[model samples]
Target: MAWAGGQVNNPTQADAMKSRLQAIEQDLSKNWEKRDELNRTAERASTELKEIQERGIGLARSLYRYSAKADSLQTRLQQMQERERSKSAAMARRQGQLAATLSALQRMARMPAATLVAIPQPPQNTIRSAILLRATVPKLKDEATRLADELRTLKALRANIAGDSKSLAKTMADLEKERLSLSFLTAKKMRLLEKTRSAEHSAATRTARLSARAGNMRELLWALLKQKQSPELRGEDFEPPPAAGKPETATAEPPTPPRQTAALAPFRLPRGPIPALGRIVTAFGAKMPNGTLSKGVYISTRPSAPVVAPTKGRVMFAGVFRGYGNLVILELPNKDHVLISGMAKISAEIGDEVLAGEPLGEMAPSTSSLPKLYFELRRQGRPINPLPPKAARRNKVRG
Candidate 1:
């Protein structure tokens, strides 16, 4: 009876252990599923962010073109209006002159031929007045012809001004439309950034602390990289492979390469096109106001001009730095760095993988002065000219 009882207890304990193992397996399966779902969500968000950025950039370009057209039309309208005012003033003066000449001619015509003899005036004086009147008739005729021509020109100028006003109105409407579209895209991007950053709040907090403590950008970057390598900030944990005898139960699909590779692969040098639509006001190595050689280029951009990434890179820093307003630093795949500064707003966040031409930020809107963007490319911690070879040579020659 004792042996039978022990056997019964043993079976019950074995059954309990088996049930617990099954529960553990189920939990592991759910966790894997959750991870996979999160990955899918992240990928979708990344793709959506890219699309929104591309569309926003296109709209921004359209806005710039339309704004330029509107400016041109406004300038032309002002010139035409000025001409109209000048023509109107000239016409008014001509009318006064013509009226005076006509009145004198009428008085001369009304005077009877007998009156000239009856007035007891000298014959020489009367003959001289008659000769002057005869000469003035041709002059008056020429003046009338010239006034008519000016009136015609004034009419044409008014018509052109009206046309330009209409064109300007149309261009402004298109610009407004593009601005609205860009605003929508920008909002979407912000929302996506918020979502992406939410998951890494702890890491971001740690990075922020590091940034605060670091003395400069170089120190900050080094600290960030070091923190990223730590387990707590890695945000990923992988289970060791099953022991040799066990069969593999799950396989992860290899990650697809980033979309920016194709666009970035062709460039041998880190320098791509200028990151924004603007004129380069200060070239690399130029003398700055402080009498120091400029380490980067300064671009005089239009108000609220869209700023894009110059090349494919991962964001290392995206925030304000000492003396630099709204700065961003990108780490290229080849271990190079690019720094962009002086933006009014930064759209990219730290650790974001950005593509070439991806919208990164915008210049501040300013009516008083054109905003300037600063761009620098660094190779192994040394500043290099970001201009193309030909452009660099041209700048050198100019200098």
Candidate 2:
């Protein structure tokens, strides 16, 4: 519509607005066409990678929420663990006190006393009298120990669940960003289509160019979506050189402690019957369920089977571990720390000295059927692949 007198009509502004609207439509159309191509390409990628990509995307969406929940759960578990530990300490103190008191009382009883007051005995043939003093004392101690152990295990499982949850949560932010980008790309695609339909191109040449641009935009969008769905992509274009003054180098890790040569520690030997176990289900080099490789060997065994210490050392740590389940850390003189996981029982107490072949612990009977002895050889805190030699590699000749 033409403007009347005195109304300075700006047709150029109208044209510009029309042009922008046309561009938006064109971009959206292009995205729509290319998204299908991307999906096909993603389907062709390695199933493992595809799975990881899907997981990563899904994780990105839920990570933040999970992290908070995990952290809270972990806090609760930690509090419970502290309580359990306190309870255990108290129990141990009581056991020590009882042993000392009983020993003292027995020694006094043995010595002739100047004054003797006969305490009233139970009625003859009473069932309570049948309880043997020796059996009763040991049973009471065993019950206390079992209670402490159960609490420890529960704490460990809680921590592990929290750890897994935190890892899951960390991925949430990334997924959300991707989702938004996807939405933007989608909207852009729709706009492109709208542009293609509404553009008032008269000449055949102009129409062809607009169509080509629309096609390119579509391809770009499709490529982006594909990139998200598949981890593999051409890096040459995306790889940027280090910016000026920002040096980049490989990050270094902490060094492990050397082996100590002190005298060996001593502790109690296992009385339970030991049984043979089976092959390792997962190994140090074995690929984890995720893309990353594992850091230790998971020896499959019956749950009740004894977890023997491969070498003599002191029980440095004994507690529940996440992912690893019940764990015992043995500190060898060689500075090699052997971590035993998935135990039904931890016979060797934490800080207790123990000899080689000593039973560290055993798994539960139910667990024995699906038993896994996750062993890790670590130097200090750094993980060392246990599949290879604790001894130096030697060359061998072939026939």
Candidate 3:
């Protein structure tokens, strides 16, 4: 009998690779989510800071106006004080005149007694004279009462104006304090936003490094797989082929041909019309559950939304596929083929010419309530990541 333990293959290496891939993907997802959240928070902070700044500026202006009003009120109160002093001086002179008149009247009342004692002119001891004296006394008392009432009114007016001036000054000072506090808070807000931005940048850099490492890992694994598939490899072992163009005993070098260049200028997108309306649920080049490359961009769109080609190409296939449900593949004239799958309906027939940004067909609702369309562009059957290929990477190891 065959050795059962020997036939059981230990998947330690495969398990390790899968674990590493999962960790990398998890880290990438976490970082992306963090990046988005940080961006949103930063925006909110900036907006709040801006609003605070605007209000603070307005408050400053208002405080300045309040201060001006305080100054004006103070000036008015000072003027009123000066007028009060002048009125007091005038009232003092008037009171002196009234006092003299009263003194003269009292002397007159005593004159009759003095005249009777010194044998001078006889006192006018008639009823009409006494009545006239009493009437004069009443008039003098009324005049003094009117003067005192006027003095009280002027004093109250001055006190009221002073009180208002003091209150206004206090209010202005409070507003100034508030304005200062707002300024400080606005500065703090700006600092917080800056720190958030820096944190996001750091996270993005980490994500980029992780992405590059993952790419290298995938490339190495694919190369290893190709080696395993080669004819020189035995059923249980692997081997590498000989280097190309090097003879059995000699090697030679030659100059390469001139390289072709293409520029990718910015393209104008039509306003209000989206090229693809969907949520990007799955990322580009995400690892599959079975430890393989997803190898495309996944978009969750509606069934009625048309999938336009990012570039001009001819339809290569428009049918079902193994994993890409209701797929359509386009092969451009430059021998570049693009795959677009996960469609619920089809519009263009096979081998039909399609223009760049042209509507492909209506989509359908996916089982996940999120319709998805997977896309990828390839050259010579090998997947090629279609980035903004504006600049070509040329070999620069010196001619």
| Candidate with the greatest lDDT versus the true structure | 1
Better of 1 and 3 by TM-score: 1
- TM-score-based ranking, best first? 1, 3, 2
Q: Candidate 1's C-alpha lDDT?
A: 0.71
TM-score of model 2 relative to the true fold? 0.29
In candidate 1, which residue ranges exceed 4 Å CA deviation?
1-9, 116-125, 198-272, 278-287, 332-337, 377-399
lDDT of 2 by residue, 133-202 (tens): 4445786677668757866775675676566556545544443454344344334433433333332222
Residue pairs with backbone atoms closer than 3 Å in model 1 (clashes): none
lDDT of 2: 0.47
> What is the C-alpha lDDT profile of model 3 across 246-313, one tens digit per residue?
32210111111111012111111321112244445554455667766656556665333445555566
| TM-score, predicted candidate 3 vs. hidden true structure | 0.38
Of candidates 3 and 2, the better by TM-score: 3
Instruction: List where candidate 3 sits over 4 angstroms from the true fold.
Output: 1-11, 113-153, 169-177, 180-187, 190-399
lDDT of 2 at 234: 36
What would the per-residue lDDT of candidate 1 be over residues 68-171, giving only the tens digit for each residue? 57657877888889889988998999899899989988998999998877767799998898899889999999999999999899888888888888888898
